[model samples]
Target: MRFTTRVLLLQLLTVVAVVATSTAVFIGLSMAQLRDEAETSALMIARTVAAEPEVRELVAEEAQDEENPPAEELAQGQLQQYAVAASQSTGALFVVITDQNGMRLAHPDEDLLNLLVSTSFSEAMEGREVVAWERGTLGESARAKVPVFAPGSDTPVGEVSVGFERAGVFDDLPRKLLFIGAAALLALVIGLIASLILRKRWEKLTLGLQPEELVVLVQNQAAVLDGVGDGVIALDTDGVIRLSNGAANRIFGILDSENLTLADLDLADDVVADLEGGTARDGVVANGRVIFLEARSVDRGGQALGSVIVVRDRTDLMALSERLDSVRAMTSALRVQRHEFANRIHVAAGLVEAGRMQEATEFLHTMRSRGPVDYPLVGVELITEPFLQAFLGAKSLEASERGVSLQIREETLVLGNVAEVEDVATVLGNLVDNAVTAAVASDELRLVEVTLLDDADQLVIVVADSGPGITPGADPFAHQPKKLAENDQDSGQLKDHIHGHGIGLTLSQDMAQRRGGEVWLVEPGGEKSRRGAVFGARLPDVMEPDDSVNYREVQEEDK
Candidate 1:
């Protein structure tokens, strides 16, 4: 059954039980009162008959006789007179007298006067009043007996027994009690029904609210927050975490996705300190990286509850801003160079016009060959040796300018037509650029190691940088993008903008992913090195010969 129905049933049954018990108690009390009243009325009638003067006179005359004459003679004379007078005065069924031995002395029926009376009458003749309700010769009756005394003496003579036919009078009380009991029972049933109806209505009204509703609301809200990229952490009043979305969990390194607790994440001391202090703070870390941490107090009903901590990855944001600054700088420098080049072209044109053709040709050749480095990083087959030499040489210069030493430890392997030459260059260029930037702050021994190896199945390029290693924390990619700053004017501001660095790493990571490879940090550990970061890029090698290749052959070649 539904919960509301069950509750209604329970309440109805409880009401019914209480009503039933109370009704039974009331009926019992009424019956007892009725019975007492009936008995008292019967006794009063008997006493009234016994106190009559004629009834007393007859008893004294009976006592004067030596032998109480046979009841037949007394019934025809003195008993007749007493019975007529007493019955007339008192509204009794019959007035009968019995001697000490229970022989009827005077009776309303002459024939019964000769019959011996029951022991109850003999007991009554000995000066005891007896009242009984029973089925007698006159049908259902209430009978009472009172002893009579002699006129001038204190001696009892005979007993006067009065019986009132009570099938009507006595039955009146029980009938009325029965009517009362029936009415009470009906009222109890009606009250029980009304109570049940009210209880059911109340249960229906309360059905909409349940504890599970709260749980569902919480889960849905948390799921929506999880879809956001920014890290969000909510806590209760006891400094315990109540909600942590995916972004927050990633930023804090909390592993359990289903059941998470505050103590399991092990947040950094700085972050925890800010949380406890209940104040918003932003600062840079020792790694030349910037982090913005904000703490806001949560409240309910004007009472301070707990605090929420939001942590944002600002590394990319700072980098993009720096890139914008660099672009502006490069634009200004290019403008100056453009003006200088225009003047030189004017001077060179004058020389050619004055017939110094050799000098003019040489100047033109130098200008054509000495342009900025421009080459497609992907989708290329064979290149001119001069172009190759210039490109490689420029990469070396670029590394040196950034305070980084870059070296190719091994010769590049040609993986046949299956390997896209331009793709290789693009992947390597990005990786090398990132390595150089990361190692810029390193000591004299700062070096970026680049290695390329090709096997039957895949070509692997490894770029290792000598710098502070990647910290152990949550996965950055798993979280959604943070909300864009309201004051930001550029689309790049929505990206992960760290405070200190440029956008090289984030751009390189995106390129790596697009090429169907992953960029991961490996802890450089051994007796030779304390710690650094190594990033590896693996791409499929799909070289094919003139003949078809089998799976077994490919496996054997890979081995």
Candidate 2:
């Protein structure tokens, strides 16, 4: 049977056993109670009969006779008439009057009128009344015996005995038992109904999964939650953290999550509110990791089971993605330069073949005058690092396609190779993208400018735009501009509408903070401001110190 059915059956059997035992006990006690009542009634009736004047006088005369009275005379005796009348009036089975020798003076049966009594009447003859359940000529009965007294003396004359048949005394037993049985049956039915209701409730709660199935499910869930790389946290409807996997515990620095709430964890108010509001977001920085987060509510059978927050780390993957994009950009730039260089070489060779030596030489001089063909952007040589050169070249191309001019400011300077390339790229990518976006929104001289500098292992990046600047006292990190999101060509999905410059700003700030740095708005411009907003980021330990020994320094000293 199913688990619920088993429980129901056990409960039903328990109710049956209890009801049956209780009913039987009531019946047994009732029989004794009824028998006691019958005996009391018989004793009272016998006492009244023995106390009568006629009965006392007749029994005294019969006891005084030298010879027993004639059987026929006693048989027709008025004493017998009195006994019959008493028996009829009292509703007793039989009533008998006996002499001192225990000879019957009066009896219900005429044949037994002058005969010796079947039961001992010593106690009655001694003037003592007795009540008992006894078997005599009339079969088993609850009987009472009493002694008759002389007219004015304490001397006992004869005895009176009255009995109620056992069957008649217990005549109400069946009815009482029937009532008890009805109650037991009602209780059984109630128990059955209660058990059935409980079974349904159990089935609904567990979705009819048996006990063994539930155990296996629980075990599997535990294994999966702990085994998976992504972080999982389960909260109740009240937002209390009921369960958390290993990754979540590590991320939040929680040793034990029992009875904790979202407030108890180290999460920002906005993040908490977003989670509570059942928001889904990706590429969010939390606790030094770029993670994808989504809060999903679970319900079953129209009952709310609360929500689960899933956190997947994308920090390493994003860094690799950026690096790949940079490589692709460099490869494209190289391929373009190769095709352009091949065309120029072909032209020069044709000029040389036609004996136009002066023209070919002038063409070579013109080609050499154009600084590196691999990077066509102006002041590209100012940024010496290959990664930065390629990354900026790609951004310049994107800006050029968007009808905006991207410039590497002439003042840009770096003393050493770039370090922490991925971290630097991530922050720069956001700031440059926003700057380009701002420039595109401007009608006057749409241009985005970038400045890169290094000061003792710190890489400082400043991006300026000619678009309308930020509003005064505004928090760019908290601003929500869906227009900027709608213009986003990345992801190409409607969900991008929820992501704004604020998300990028926040993510960038989080990355900077990890390196003991920060990204901040350096200049806030008004709507009509000629120069657009300027954003700066100071990333510590992103470049090598100039003081470090290198081949150039050693060669300079040798010279």
Candidate 3:
């Protein structure tokens, strides 16, 4: 059956049951009360007939005789007349007067007079009134027996018995039952009307969907929402969160999504603003993860529904981009060194061909001792790791090309192989790139200083420049990109990654934090500062290694 029909039927059945039970109880009590009324009326009539003064006098006279005598004609006639009148007035079936010996003196039928009564009369003769349903010569009835007394007499002179027919007592009961049945029917009708109204309301509340449809909808939601890898958040028109996927919960680091809203989550202001604006936003940082979000308004039949937000985590992609930048910087420096070496070789060849053999030998010796492209200004002699040495050399060359000086501090010392060199390079490389950009923009000397320290337990890199420090009233480690958009061009990061939208410092901080480390600004590069901004990144558990693998040896072994 349809759910609405079933509900209506149930309501009708409940009303019927209640009405039936109540009617039965009421009818039972009414029948009892009517029967009692009949018995009481019969008893009252019998007593009144027995109390007549003339009949009492005649009965007393008749009893005065010593010998047993027949009922006195005058007394019996008067008693019979009175009985007839009482029976007619009270609507009793019959009225009978019997002497103390149980011989009837007055009866409804004249032939029954002077006959022995068919039912018990002993209790009435002994001065006790009796009332019960009994079978007698008059037929079945609710009968009452009362003792008749003479004037100032304690003894019963005779007994008066009155009866109401069994059928007559319940004559009006059928009409009452008809009314009660009608009331039950009326109640059922009211209940059905209420059920119909309720059904309409229920349909509206459920959006005209049935119970089975609702169940299927819930099941589909669970299967689809939790299965997707990308995070999904759905909101109503009022910005209330209606649905949030498991991936969204994980991305926001929330334990429960119940009663959650966009404002309740610790999302970056830029990301939230973009979502509210109903536009697609890329490179938005949230919860230390590079997030790209697409927000689009949903509608049904041109009616506004709400919005759905899709979030993509791009932290790993941004890290890779930073590493690629480092490699590119190194490649450019190698090309410069290779071109310089080629020029030196050509010069030595020309000198030898001129027969100046001693000058060519000294020239080759000098080139070998000093090494080609020795950037003497940056203090590269103190750094020993080839990768770091080459990477910093490339950065210095790149800086000089941009008209900015890149300097390595004299106190910097890193003597062992870094276990995670790519991670370290990503952090320091971004810092150097940003510093170089800032130095190029500064009016003071265009110089950038770098400090690398590996103190066995941790790796620390500090980059300071001659440019203005960080923007005032900004937390350097925060994921806010407002300062970067205002003052920097994302430090010239990749175009595709969200971190490229000015999260360089945030990316470095996230990488360091992953290894139980931190990144912070030692000085804000603004107008009030003597020097440029200085940023420091410290990574714990970045210890020195006992041995290092050579790229060439590994390739030769594979061959």
Candidate 4:
């Protein structure tokens, strides 16, 4: 049923219940009141008749003499006549007078005259007045019995009985109930009208949405919000969080989704203000994850309803982008090497065709002595591992193109292969690229030094450049501003856009930290250290094989 209809029905039932209960109580009380009034009037009439001097004297005479004649019983007849006149005038059913022995002296029914009363008169004889419901010869009535006292005496000589018919006593009730029923009916009609009005108002309040529609809306909202990977948060105009999806709750680290606001989450004020203001913020970090944020204001009929915030996590996308950049750099270096090798081959071919056979042989010998065409750098050969050798050679080519000399330290010694080549590559790639940039910008001869060490438990990488060291009072590893570089176009976006400026170092540290390792500046760039800022990365669980264990085994056996 529609909500308004249900409300109307509920109100109707409530009013009916109240009216019915009230009517029942009122009917009972009214009936009792009317009956009591009848009894009181009857008692008053009886007492008045009994107080007459002539009636009391006659009753006293009748109690003294039992035998009497119709013609001689003049005083007794007078009392009977008076009672008949009183019964008629007062609208009583009947009025009777009896002696102390309970024999009637006067009765409305002439045939019942001079006979014992057909109802109890014991209380009246004992000098007490009584009023109650009783069935006599006159039928059931509200009757009263009072003692007939003589002049100037409290003692009773006889008794008077007065009765109002039971039917007559309830005659006014139907009329009274008619009024009551009419009032109740009118009240019910008014209540129904009020319920209908309230129903219409309720319809307007709920925008005419039925209970079933609201149910469907809730179900659909849950389905859409919970099924999507993106986080959604809806807030009221007052900035109170009204609805939060499962993704939002999980992303914001909220323990409870209800009755929460952005302030409750202790978010940065600028972020909260931006969200409330319907401004979009991109690449925000929360709970150690990168989030892309979009805010939209919701309005209906030109009224501001609230705002909705959509959040997309960019952490994985950023990692993938970083890997792609590394691959692209490698590809670029390979292209350069291929072009250089092609030139050398062309020269050797030309030399052979020109009849300079000895020189061509010498050139072939020189090229062979130089090892692989891809491994152009002499210092890179110190690291015999093919992947690092190629990676460093590629970086060397990239550095040389930028007028920066990139070289591997002579003391660098890594015997076994790196366990996780990607991790080492990512950290080393970022460090080398950043060093190259710093070196290229320096006034002195651009030079960068790279050192690689595998100490059985960790792979340690250090990169130092001959350039102006880290800026004063700046933390390269910490969060930095996203201010656009003066050469944003030329410099391009770094491998880690999430970290903004100095992204290379920040992302390198993040990647290193993820592998139970750390990357930090071992030395800031200054005169104190000849090499500019020297950064070191210690990656755990990524080391060459344990050759020392085998060496120890051999030594033990010999012993």
Candidate 5:
């Protein structure tokens, strides 16, 4: 059967059982009460007859006789008349007067007069009263017995027995039982009707799906929600998170998402607005990660069902693109260096061809003393590390391609090699990249100046650009770009894949903050003469100490 049908059947059965049991108990109690009433009336009639003065006098006169007389003698006597009168008046089945010897003086049946009574009357024989249900010659009945006292005396001479026939005792009870049965039937009808209504409601609520189908649907939903790589957040119409899978929790770096709304989450305002408006947005930073989100409302038959957001993480992809940009910049610098070498070689060849060996030798010596100058960056010889040299060189070449003069300040100095070069690159590269982009967008002289300072084990970097400086007293990190749809003009690729205005900067700040450092704005740089924005960062424990243990050895040993 269908789910609702089975449920209705169960509910109906339950109601039926309950009503039936209650009706049965009520019938039992009613029958008991009727029996008690019957017995009480029978006892009251018996006592009334036993206390009758004429009936007592006659019974006493009969007891005075030494020999038992034939019941026919007193069958028409006053004792018989009283028994017959009491039986007729009270509607009892029989009213029998018995001597103390348990012999009946009068009975409804004249044939039973003078015979020993069949049912127990011992208690009544001792001058006491008794009431009970018993079976006698007249069949089962609610019977009572009471002792008769001699006229004006305390001695008991005889007893009076009164009985209400079993059938007669329950005369009105049939109507009561009939009413109870009718009520039970009505209750059953009501229960069935209620069950049918409930079944209809259940069908509507479940869309008429069977239990097995619902189970399969739930399993499918679980698989689809949990098996996907991208994060999915399902919300109710109230904007409360109803469902959040493992990927979503992991992406947001939270342990639970129960009952949390968009405002409850640590999301940027632009991200929140996109979610609330149900729009697709890209390159929004959340929890220091670049995530592209596509949000849309869910509805069915014009009923608003709420909203859903699919989040795609792009941080790793952006990082790879940045590395690719670095490689491309390095490649361009190599081409420039090769072209310069060719010119120098051409000059030497011309000197040698003219038989000026001395000039050629001096030129070669001068080149050797000049040291490696492949990088186009100014002051390339100040730093000794090969990685930083290549990195800054690539950055300078990149800046030059965009018409910006990228140079290290004259005061830049360092005491030791950068210990965590990758960390240094992550923080420094972001600041310099932002500065270069800002300088390119400036109306002032397109120049970006970088300075590096080493104090203890900390490395400080500052990048100033001739951009339209930040607003006064405004947080530079406050602005978030909702989406990046522009293409990289030079590379014929979507630049949104490689960068976002706030995303990279947030990641840089997070990495620095993890090491007890910070990135801050030194100068908003929109003053009359200042003309540009300057950003600074301090990264601790990134400098190699003079007497430090070998980090590589420890890593290898741990592995």
Candidate 6:
């Protein structure tokens, strides 16, 4: 049920319980008061009738009947008349005078004069006032008995008994209780109906939102994000992951929610620390390969609530950037080739105008021999323009200038697409440049080896150099500047301070990741005296069977 409905029902039930208890207590107290008042009124009437002078005189006349009362029978008749008058004066239902033997003498009803009095009258005649229920010709009644004594004597002559019908006192009580109960029940029904109506109205106003709405909203948002190709991960202030898009899950190979955490995504330790420390930070990763984690404080109305971390996958963007760099390099090389070709045509035109046929033929032959041709590597015909080849050749020469021997190992068995030829050249160029710089200070054999091989389902390009391998203890991709001095033979503490803080491997690694691949430093062997860094790149194989044959023939023809 909706929240509003549940709240309304709970409130209605509480009101009902309270009203019921209160009504019950009121009815009980009212009945008790009425009962006490009825009892008191009955006792007062019994006492007043017993104290009547006629009652006293009747008792006296009866006592003296044995001595001087045959002539006084007329006086006794007058006393009996007075006793009847006293019974009428008290508003009791009935009054009877009973002698010591429990026999009625004077009664409100004349026909009841000879009737047997109740046992309660006998108890009263023995000097005790008695009150009890008794069955009479008129049904049951509450009877009170009081003893009458002779004038100025303590001896009981008879008992004056008074009765009041109990039905009258109890009659209105049930009706009043019924009225109160009806009111309570009516209030309860009205309250419940009001609660239900309000609940329905609330549900309508809220657009029928329930607990399931929250779940559905979240799931829908996640579904929309999952369609995106870029990885996205979000985390709350506690360093606990809140959401991860499909791309992110696949990139990290996180198939289960249980293994996801802030640390697993290569988020900066300080950023994680700040989240743990309740601070907010936002920045991009240097390489732009892994997710870039940025944290910012979440707030409401100027109050600091928590922090939110947004992760963006820059892998594809980085690849696009590398492709752009390759295009630029190719463009530059093509511009140079155009200029050189224009100069050669001008020189040939001058030779033909001077009528130097032999010399012009020699010049033509030299130009043809010097024309750019593609190189073959790893059985793959290098389909790139001559300008790119020249760029790589110049980079190789630069490495040699730095005392680093550039070696190229060609695999004769593999062929792959040249779609990324410019990009491959750029990547190799950068690696050779960095290797030359790193190997310049090494006392060991400074050699940079570029090897191409075909692995199952992919083409692997390995670049290994004889230089100090990446600092063994830390992450090879750590964001530190390149060490300026390989040997600590510099001036002072300042030299040591500036060493080992570079971004070469970090940059190269970022490039490798952009091509749907990775770069790793191969472990060195125990027997090998050379200690250097080895970087490898793996690209998807795009060579067809016919292309493989042509590529192999091209390499053979080159040989």
Candidate 4's TM-score reads 0.71
Supply candidate 2's per-residue lDDT for 173: 94
Tell me the tens digit of each residue's lDDT in model 2 across 175-222: 999998899999999999999999999998898889999999999989
Decreasing TM-score order of the candidates? 5, 3, 4, 2, 6, 1
TM-scores for all candidates: the values are 0.41, 0.61, 0.77, 0.71, 0.81, 0.51
* Model 4 agreement with the true structure over 310-359: per-residue lDDT tens digits: 98877667666777777776677677767878999999999989999999
lDDT of candidate model 5 versus the reference = 0.77
> How well does candidate 3 score on lDDT at residue 197?
91
Per-residue CA lDDT of candidate 1, range 58-150, in tens? Answer: 766766767757655776776667676776676667767765555677776777775676446665656788877766555666677788776
What residue runs in model 1 are displaced by over 4 Å at the alpha carbon?
1-234, 241-259, 265-269, 279-295, 307-398, 408-410, 413-434, 437-446, 452-460, 465-498, 501-516, 521-533, 539-559
Give stretches of model 2 more than 4 Å off: 1-23, 47-80, 97-106, 110-131, 145-160, 175-227, 230-316, 326-418, 445-464, 469-503, 513-525, 528-531, 534-544, 548-559
In each prediction, how many residue pairs overlap at the backbone (N, C-alpha, C within less than 3 A)? 16, 0, 7, 1, 0, 7
Evaluated at residue 183, the lDDT of candidate 1 is 76
Model 6, 328-374: lDDT tens digits are 65665566556777888788889999998888888888666554322
lDDT against the true structure, per candidate, is 0.57, 0.79, 0.77, 0.77, 0.77, 0.59
Supply candidate 6's per-residue lDDT for 202: 72
lDDT of 2 at 494: 12
Best by TM-score: 5
Instruction: Give per-model CA RMSD.
Output: 14.0, 8.7, 6.6, 6.6, 6.4, 11.9
Highest-lDDT candidate: 2
